[model samples]
Target: MNCKSLQPAAKKCVNEDCELHEKGFAKYFCNICNLFDDRPRPIFHCPYCNTCRMGLGLGIDFRHCMRCNACVSLADKDHRCIPQKLQGSCPICHDTLFNSTEPLKGLRCGHVMHLSCYNQYCRGQNYTCPLCMRCMEDMSDYFSLLDQAVRMQAMPAAYQNTICNIYCQDCEKTGECRYHFVGLKCTQCASYNTREMGRYEQLAAFPN
Candidate 1:
């Protein structure tokens, strides 16, 4: 079997007579670099990561983040830094993230997860990071729509003037807002992704 033809293939060589047929042909094989290589892009061994990675070589298309202990794309150079963010598994699927072959995505909260998992998670209407409970993307437009909806529907008379102590997951702040069955808006960031802590009281109860 011609080894050149299998240079770009990731599957094992099927030539029955070939000695290495069972071993297969790896496009990114580097005998001197590492024993096993499965990365999609051009393979380069990262000393800090102690494994093979796909990129234009370190310091070119990627850089090793000491804090995260992983190689990150140059495009994410200015991303929010989280301590040992890549050391954990994907929050959605619980798959290892450190050496995963799948594409990784960085959340706004500085958490990391598999790109595919992130897509599936978002399709479920979950917009927050699983670990931090913070918004994964800009939710201002969605929150604005919720604001309009809240304004259009008045609360029932029994619950009117009632307030709730809430915690804003996006801004990580605590404040009070008028209780609504739809959602509670944060007083600080105007975000509706809040959790009700407890009821404040009806303003009419202490009327002047």
Candidate 2:
């Protein structure tokens, strides 16, 4: 059988372990495995991924997440797991996360994204997971403040009964809510950033 089309008219290896032995092509045959190639970086063959991945066992600051099927930073070893989370595009920038050379950051929600993209997203005053809409950090204190402000009716009565179209900074969803004496809550994520598209109206108090 002629195995000419496998690689080019290159040198052939007779070793049975060599991948090019049966194919009859050998460019840079490894004496051990006998396969064509000049690998530059430290390529670590992942048995799980069934492929060679660069930057392993070379003082690389990352750990392979078996659940995500990708390498995440060592700092994120304790991050939550979302099965096959890193297999697709990032939720923040919608860019492919796998095999990317950019710096990646794993969220508490088990999602990962480009570090720069995540920084820019948070710079826009959002502090929640873009995919799950869960608070990235514990904001129970802030929520308590909001709750207190509502109980005390700290907002001026002039703002009462106002109709506001709220866009949640956390969830990126929109809804309309009637203004109260304190804060307007988003119907979607219940976030208090209901400051968008506000319209004032004179809603009279209901008679008891």
Candidate 3:
């Protein structure tokens, strides 16, 4: 067969001897970069955010890419589709319930769906949990916000742009992980700096 006619085989990226996992989009990139490839060649990290994610071996029953059109990034409520600012459509299913000004719940996973629509979806799939399908986890956290007459602590508008955050030196998770802003500190002092963007982090820890 001609070189162009032959399709590349699906090879597992790890040593699990399984076929579910495969190389991410790029094949020339390394799994990690820590004094590994400094010779002057360019490195490809990830598609969305390049970080030289190489040598990051895969494991059985694990996935790195799901092509999820998560609801967290949208055209409303910082594109997060908060129930109060849902103004877009679901990229995955293209639901039209997002274009509303009233309280409309969009999934935290970037799926803009009506609260009722999601409930109906769950009801049909033998009540399968919406996220990850690993059985529903306790979700009283997000729902409690919907309860009226709930006197929640108020965040000053000054902190609307604030991004309270932390950077764990261990695991380098704080800097590497996206949610590191939860416990971030003041760059000028030892006090907890609620200033994300070092200027606008509006949320405090939800439960504590």
Candidate 4:
């Protein structure tokens, strides 16, 4: 496409009514209006089409939702708290969310919390998830996963071995143990602490 030929996807000849609206290929300026939809409406409840394409314009950069498994098309510091359909008290304060301040913040574990509660939960030591315990660096990743975790997953099998199983120092139970080298998920014999990890030691396999 050429830079001289572009328009709103909603108006162009592109597949969805606007192929000419190919981003960057054209000015993306409305001919008569001579301005972009600065608000870039998500087209939710479009009376013209009588359809709601809420997620159509969303991109990877869209902020992750502080509560549910969705994304917010805004930045963390600028996130707007809105009524969410998901049900749960603020994870940090355990306060009812029906009328309380919305938890417009998120944890890597997907737990939702109000910004104030999140800070207080960490006791000013440095706020993070009570469950994941992942330290918060910048406000940006407050709702996203750490990059390193994903990088490790890309390693080969040699990097996928379980070194040992963790156990309670005194309980002598494998329930609390984690096989870091092998894997994280515990078999039916036990439940790995998804929210928490425990100490471990090498042990022989049990007889089937």
Candidate 5:
């Protein structure tokens, strides 16, 4: 559409409802989408996405992942299947991640986290999901290290026979095992984040 023709000498249009009457095509604008074009080339807006997108002559082929609650490449529909609903804060940063403006990094276990938060986490030594104990990506080296540690180390004589109740974060199972300085190991999944429970306290999964 010829936006210049819409801008009268009075810097307004006869149609008061038209947004261009107030601001006529500032630099590069799309009358159809009613947004400033950020790219050097023309862009189109997907009503479903409610955001601008880029494409060649054919048009962008992005698809929204309902589970992820975000737009993804058309070819990448088979993402890690998260059975639960997408809601609440990020497991890593404790910030609202669902329906957030920031891009997300989906894990194989079906949980989604901020891309920036994930990058920052990768800078550390560990490589496991913060919410679940499942490995976020390939951690064969880390797993091997843990295996060697478990094999080479032994519990102290004092705590060697003391039985303790524990809960597994990954498998959501409970079992009893001997305690050690390293950590309480879950008999189910071998995750060390298990918490010791008192005789009165019933076994329960940690709050998500």
Candidate 6:
């Protein structure tokens, strides 16, 4: 049924001998089915979702996203869209995200996770989206510090010219960089968020 046609149940019951009428339990009435309920006030039925949801009403606090097939906050109308983004489980907790009551946070990569989970994950020093392994926030300052640290450290005599293959999570590219125990910087983006593929080949040792 269209949500506009669904009316709030009546507050009082007309049945004289009904238990709800005697105890004043009937506080809402479903106009379509002629049923009374004591659930709560301000409940709304969403035609798009085809379910009764607790909120201020559709288009007031939230709106339905046809692409995601879920109701999202009105404030997030311009949020980045990922195909069926809300239809998956939280990456951290592995709990269902659709219709979940917990607050959610969206990442730059267009991934979503429970707000609490995001906080805990950040507190654990993880700054990338778990699903895509992409940097979730600007890491320019952090990467600059790594650059300074790498510059100050000198490689051992035997490995001075050593180079290694690395795949960068930030740039999503594979390249080679001078081998350093601190971290391998992406040759393309100069980001230290990279993993060594393996030691390439050793060359003539040279001073840094």
Best lDDT among the predictions, by candidate number? 1
Model 5, range 15-118, lDDT digits (tens) per residue? 66667667654545545555565347644555555555553312356665565555555655557656443466787788876446577787767777888999
Order the candidates by lDDT, highest first — what do you get?
1, 6, 2, 5, 4, 3
Predicted candidate 4 versus true structure: per-residue lDDT over 1-208, tens digit per residue: 3344444543344444444445422333344433334354432222222223333444433534545434555555544344352356776667764334243556544456676887676676654456444434343352233233433555354433334344421122444332343234333323223333444333554321
* Candidate 3: stretches off by over 4 Å: 1-88, 91-93, 101-103, 108-110, 126-208
Model 1 per-residue lDDT tens digits across residues 1-208: 4643444333455566665577655656655453555546587888888887777788788888898788888887558888888778888889998889899999988998899998999899899888989989889999889888888998888788788889999889998878889899888988887899999667565221
Query: On TM-score, who's better, 1 or 5?
Result: 1
lDDT of 3 by residue, 51-152 (tens): 333223323221233243222322334232233233346332556543332234444333345556666666675322243332232333433442221234
Using TM-score, give the best candidate's number: 1
At residue 78, candidate 4 shows an lDDT of 46
Segments in model 5 whose C-alpha atoms lie over 4 Å from true places: 1-33, 38-47, 53-62, 74-78, 81-101, 121-135, 138-140, 198-208
User: Scored by CA lDDT, what does every candidate get?
Assistant: 0.80, 0.64, 0.35, 0.43, 0.61, 0.75
Give the clashing residue pairs of candidate 1, or none: 12-24
Angstrom error of the Cα, residue 113, model 4: value is 0.8
The per-prediction CA RMSD against the true structure, in angstroms, equals 6.0, 9.1, 21.2, 16.0, 8.4, 6.6
TM-score of each: 0.78, 0.49, 0.20, 0.30, 0.57, 0.68
Off by over 4 Å in 4: 1-71, 74-85, 98-103, 124-128, 131-164, 167-208
lDDT of 6: 0.75
**Candidate 5, after superposition: displacement of residue 64 in Å?**
2.5
